[model samples]
Target: MARLLLLGAGHAHMTVMAHLPEIISRGHTVTAVGPLSRHYYSGMGPGMLGGTYTPEDISFPVQQMIESRGGEFILDKAVRVDAKSKKVLLQSGREIEYDVCSFNTGSSVPQSIVNANATDVYSVKPIENLLAGRKRIQSLADRGKISIGVVGGGPAALEVAGNAAACAREAGCKNVSVRLYAGKVFLRHLSPRVRSLCASAMRKHAIQIIEGSYASGVATKKVTLEDGREFDEDVIFIAMGVRPSALIAESGLPVGNDGGLAVNRFLQCDEHPDIFGGGDCIWFKDQPLDKVGVYAVRQNPVLYHNLIARMEGGELQPFDPGGEYLLIFNTGGGTGVLHKAGISFGGRLAFFIKDYIDRKFMREFQP
Candidate 1:
């Protein structure tokens, strides 16, 4: 039986879990390694902060789901991958041998930036970090003085800033304030209309928008901008871009300029066919994909099929992202904006659509 080892219980891996029964029936053993037993769906993060969903509502109990699907679930972090040796090194000092391996470990903010503002910087990747940051802001707001500084101009930063403002208001803090440091061009990827709507929502929520400069560094009491301006911020959240785990580059794998593992259309590592990766960790050679859940979610089915095909000595399927996907930005208080193909719209209806889609997606992984 071929041994198939999965690194990280990310969204794509969850799809693999859904197909585990068939893979096991075909005579292959499956094992998943990750530090957490539950994987939080990042789509609901804004709602989570807005008090619309709890952690449990957006997370999948991966161990339970994997075990129920007849797969081994290891609660350990994968530190290294010896592709030539077909082995994966875990944090617990165990080396697991495998015939084939796939990575969906996701990405994180650069350590340099984290360290530059370690005193107040909180990342949004782990979900827990954002939650803790939310609680800290709440506590400070309750005490009567709070200022939130968010870095990055992408969806994550916008969602975080908007909902965080709403969270503070819901906590009854009249002294709360939020400021967004949108480097140079804010939401450059989104349509102009969507950008305008987002700006309006931020305005409505009382969040300040500062464009034309990026954050240079963060101090305990304020954040410094590249343009030599400083804002007094009690807390700073770094939602800037994320890069793949250092293990990929450290393992001698071919990577993209952005530090993500380089993969072909088949989703296999270019230099190592037996090794595969998808989701945020992979940089597709044909088309550069944004590090967004929309792309990751689309890769799920393709990764599922290709992994099974590799183990069964069958043909692998190719992945094509096609075109830009729709995006929904929740601005809290039963309001949201939808962006697709350069067109944008929003209202109470948009929020309901977003809530329905997110809830349905989360329900699929429930035991």
Candidate 2:
């Protein structure tokens, strides 16, 4: 029986977990590793921060799901992969030998720009960090006025800024203020119409959108701009986007310019066909994809099929990223900005659509 190793309890691996019984019945052993037993759906993370959803609402019991399906689960972080030895090294000094391996390790927010010792400085990643920041912000706002700073020009920054304001307001803080430090023009990569709608929504929420300069440094309750300006705040969120985990590159595997595991159209590493990956952790050689969950969700079935195919010497299937995906941003205050196929709009209806889709996605994956 061949051994299969799955890394990270991310979107693409969810399908593998669901079909673990079938894989085991086919004479293969499955083992999954992740830092956390529960996998939180990032799409609903902002809602959790804004008190629209609880931690339980957006998380999946990954460990339980794996064990129930007759698969082994390891609650440890993978530090490196010895591709030549066909082994994966864990932080705890454990080595797992696998005939086939796949990565869905996700990504992390770059924290180098922020002071490591700074307090109340949060990164818009790990999803759980937002919950802690929410509690801290609410506790501080319970006393008096507070100013929050959000650094980044992407959708993640907008979501955090708006939801943080909503969180403070829900705590009955009447003097809560939010400022978004959008480097250069906000949403520079998006359509002008989407940018206008987003800006309007920010203004409606009394959020100050600061552009022209990027945040050069982030410290406790203070942010220094590249243009030599400074702003003091009660809390700061560093949403400077995300980067793939360094494990793949550190393991001496082939990677793309973004440091993601480089994979071919079949989602297999060209140099090592037995090694496969998807999600934000992989760079598809055919085309560069946005680091969004939609692509990972699409790669699910293909990864599942190919992993089994490799073991059985069957033909592998090529992954098609598909057509335009619907993009929705829950910008707090019970509103959202949605864009799909050149159609863009904003308001409560958009939020409802996003909410319905997110909840449905959770239901489908949650065991």
Candidate 3:
């Protein structure tokens, strides 16, 4: 029997776990490793921070799903991949040998701009950090007025800033304020209309949007602009985009410019065919993909099929990124901005649509 080692309990890996019975029945032993037993759905993470959903509503019991399906689950972080020996090194000093391996390791926030002495600083990753930030905001607001600073110009930063304002409001703290350091232009990559809608939404929540400069450094309860101006904040959130897990590049494997595992159309490693990957952790050779959850969700079936085919000596299917995806930003106060195919709209109806879709997705994977 061949051994399959699955690294990280990400979106694509979750689908694999749902179909584990088929793989196990094929006489293949499966082993999954992750830093956390439960994987949080990043799509609804900002809503959870805004008190729109509970933690249990957006997280999946991945460890239970794997263990119940005759697969072994290890609650440990993967430190390295010894490709030559076909073994994975864990943070706990254990080595696992596998005939085949897959990575859904996900991405991480860049921390180079953060100072060592920074306090109350959080990253919009792992999804769980938002909960902690929400609690901190409530705590600080209980005493008096609190200033929260969010640094970044991307969609993640916008979501964080909007939800943070809602989090305080839900906690019954009216003295809370939010400032978004949106660099040169807010949502610069998006259409002008979408950017304007997002800015209006932020203004509706009394959030101050600061542009024309990016954050150069973050220190103790302070964010410094690139132009040498500093703003004091009770809490700070860094949402300056994400980078693929360093484990792939650190293991000396082939990587793209973004340091993600370089893979082909079949989602198989260019140099190591036995090594497959999806999600934000892989750099597609055919084209560059945005680091969005939609791509990860779309890769689920393709990865599941390819992994089984690789083991069974069957034909493998290539992955198609598909057309433009629908994006809905939940901008607090039961409001959202929906965009698809260059068409955009905003209102309560937009939020309702997003909420329905998000909840439906959770129900599909969460039993």
Candidate 4:
């Protein structure tokens, strides 16, 4: 029986966890190494920002799930991976020898945002911290005018700005403003019609959208843009992009230009054939796809196939992300945007659709 090691509890790793029993039944040993025992559903994070769900709704116990499937779960960060030697070393000083290794170490907040000294600014990648920001926001309730400035025009920024607006209204706050900043190219992955629909949705919800710009730096109750435009905001939400976590660099594995694990179409590193990576941690050699949870979710089946094939000495089939796929965004005022196949849909029904998709994704993968 071969021993297989899975790293990280990201979406793709969690998907493999569900099928772990089959691997064990076939006599292959299974073990998962992760820093946190809980995994977060990033797609549903916006819902939590809108106060539609709780922390429990978005988190799942990884350790319990792995054990239930007869796999050992190691709640420790993988510090180093010796692909040539087929061994991995954990932060807890444990060495794990494996026949095959798969990595799903997820991305983190972009360094551009994190390294900047932006007062009262927050990031969206670490949802747990955003939950704490909610409490700080609540404390400002009834204390006078408060405004939140959101940088980036992606779905996450839109979700944060929209949710903050809705939250301010819900908290009975008056004179609250939500401002969003976008680069020259906003929502470039989406079609023009869809972008226009989303913009209208934001405008209708009273979430101000400032396109073709960048926020230079932030101060308490103020934001200075690169173009000299200024905004008075009590808080700044940084929701632009994400970078692969530092654990990757620490692992001593080769990463791509995008700061993610370099992998081929089969999700295998060139120098480390046995070390496969998926989720946002991967930078596919051909075309670097957008960092979206939908892409990660779509990768589950292919990752499953490759992992199962490795156990049986079978060939792995590569999966390609299409040029365009469905893109959904919630505007935080109980409305959202759904763009698919060059069509756009929005409103309360769109929010319901978003909710259904998130709930279904979580339920199907429940450990």
Candidate 5:
């Protein structure tokens, strides 16, 4: 039996955990490792700020699920990979040898804005950080008016701004204010109509929007822009997207210009077949996929099948990520927006659809 080591409890890896029985039935010993006890669905991240779901509602207990499936679960972070030795180094100063390994560690928040006066600045990552930021906002609301600043203008930032506004209102803070610094352009990834709709929603909630500039520095209570303009910000949330996880690049694996691990058609490391990867951490030029949840979700079945095949010495299957997929944004208050290709729509129905899909996905990992 081959020893299969699955790294990270990310969306893709969690799928593998759910199918541990299938892998074990083939005479393979599976071990899953990560730092978090539970895995949060990023789709419900906006729901977190909007008071629709708690951490428990959006996350699944990783360790419990793996253990129930009779697979080993280690709650430790992977810091290094010795491809030549076929071993993984953990943060606890231990190492594990494996016949095969798959990484779905997701991405890390970029620290370009980290500075000496970045006390009140927080990076939105690991999901737990967002929960902690929510608590901090709730607590600070009791003191006085709260100035919430969001950096980034993508779909994620839009959802965060809207949900945060709703959260502030639900917390009984009437003087809550939100400012979105959408570096350069706003919603450039969406169609013009969709962008207009999103901008309208933020404006309706009185979220101050700033365009054509990025945050140059952050202070304890202020954010300075590249144009030398500054604003008082009580709390700043960094949602400026993510970069590849450092473990992949540091492992001396082939990586893309973006630092994401270079993977081939079968999701195997371009340089090492025994080491495979998927999710936000991988970059496959032939099947270039966006660093989004939808691709990772779709890759689960393929990854699972290929891993089993690789162990059985069977032919590998190629992965092809087809054209555009739907993009939905929960705009708080049981309303949301949906966009795909050149089409766009918004309503409570959209939110319901997103909620149903998210719940269904989370249910698969539930005990």
Candidate 6:
């Protein structure tokens, strides 16, 4: 039997770890290592942010699930990989030897962005960690009449804008001004209907949708745009660009233009077949898809096949990500917008349906 190590309890590993016995029964040893005892899935994070669901609803026990299948589970971060030796260097100073490895460690914001002068700044990643930062924003918002700026136009940014507004209202902030700042039109990936729905919902919630402008930096509770315009911001959430966790890029692997680790169709590192990857950390050969949770969720099966194949000396399989994955994003006032196949929907019922669908989607992963 070969010793196989899983580097993170991210989306892809969460999917396959639940079925770890299948991998074990095939005569391979498995080890799952990461800092968290459980993984809070990004798919259900918006719900948590909007107060539609509790934290427990969106989280799953990773260590228990993997250990139950007779695999060693270590709650630690992987610092480096010795590809030639087939071993993972753990931050805890332990060395994990493996015959095959897969990485689902995911991505996080740069400390520079969060530690900058922007005290109100927040990055939409590492959902659980975001919660602590969100709480600080919530407290400041409670003081009333807060000018909130969401510094990105993507779905996650949209959700931050919406959730920030919702939390403001929940904290009883009157005259709250929530604005989204993007260098271009918001929700550009969606169809016209979806865009209209999103804007309409933002308007209804008293959230201002500001487009075609970038947030340059913050100074003394004020945000400066690229056009030299200044706006008061009691709270700012930096929802812009994502970088693969620094350790991944530092591993000396081939990477895509955005500095994400380069991988073949099977999510295996192009330069090192024995070392595999998934989630927001990997870049496919053909397209530069964003590090969305949907794409990470889609990588599960291929990662499962390829990891096992590598352990058993079988053929590696290709991962075919769906052409378009659906997204139901929050507008921040107890409402959300839906997007799929260039189509969109809005309104209260739309938000309710979105909640139902998202909750049901995560249920499949529940034990």
RMSD to the native, candidate 5?
1.3
Cα RMSDs of all predictions?
A: 1.5, 0.7, 0.9, 2.3, 1.3, 2.2
Cα lDDT of model 1 by residue, 1-367, tens digit: 8999999988877788888898899899999998898898888887788777888998999999889999999999988899988998898999899998999989887545444535756777787677787787777777776888888888888888988887787788888789988999888887789999988888888889899988887667677888899888888888887888878998888999888899999999878889999888888898888888878788889998998888888999999887867788888767888977766887778789899998998887677
- Per-residue lDDT of candidate 2, residues 115-222 (tens digit): 878999888899999999999998898777999999999999989988999999999998988999999989898999999999998998899999999989999999
Model 4 misplaced regions, further than 4 Å: 113-119, 219-221, 249-252
lDDT of each candidate versus the true structure? 0.84, 0.93, 0.91, 0.79, 0.85, 0.76
User: What's the C-alpha lDDT at position 45 in model 6?
Assistant: 74
Query: What C-alpha root-mean-square deviation, in Å, does candidate 2 show against the real structure?
Result: 0.7
In the range 4-105, model 5's lDDT, one tens digit per residue, is 999987787766888898889889999989888888888898789778999999998988989899899999999999998999999999899998899889
- Model 6, residue 338: displacement in angstroms? 2.0
In candidate 3, stretches whose alpha carbon ends up further than 4 angstroms from where it belongs are none
Candidate with maximal TM-score: 2
- Runs of candidate 6 with Cα error greater than 4 angstroms are 110-118
Please, what is the TM-score per model? 0.96, 0.99, 0.98, 0.91, 0.97, 0.91
lDDT of 4 by residue, 1-367 (tens): 8888988878877678888898899899999998777887888776676677788898878888999999999989887777778888888899999988888888876635333554566778777766766666676768867787888867788778788777777777787788888766666666788788888887886777887777776666677778888778787778877888676677677888877888888887788777787888888887888888877877888888887787678999796886676777877877888877767888888888888888888888786
Candidate 5, lDDT over the whole model: 0.85
Q: Which prediction has more favorable lDDT, 3 or 6?
A: 3
* Best-first order by lDDT: 2, 3, 5, 1, 4, 6
The candidate that wins on lDDT is: 2
For residues 164-195, what per-residue lDDT tens digits would candidate 3 score against the true structure? 99988887786888999999989999999999
For residue 268, give model 5's deviation from the true position in Å.
1.0
Q: How many backbone clashes does candidate 2 have?
A: 0
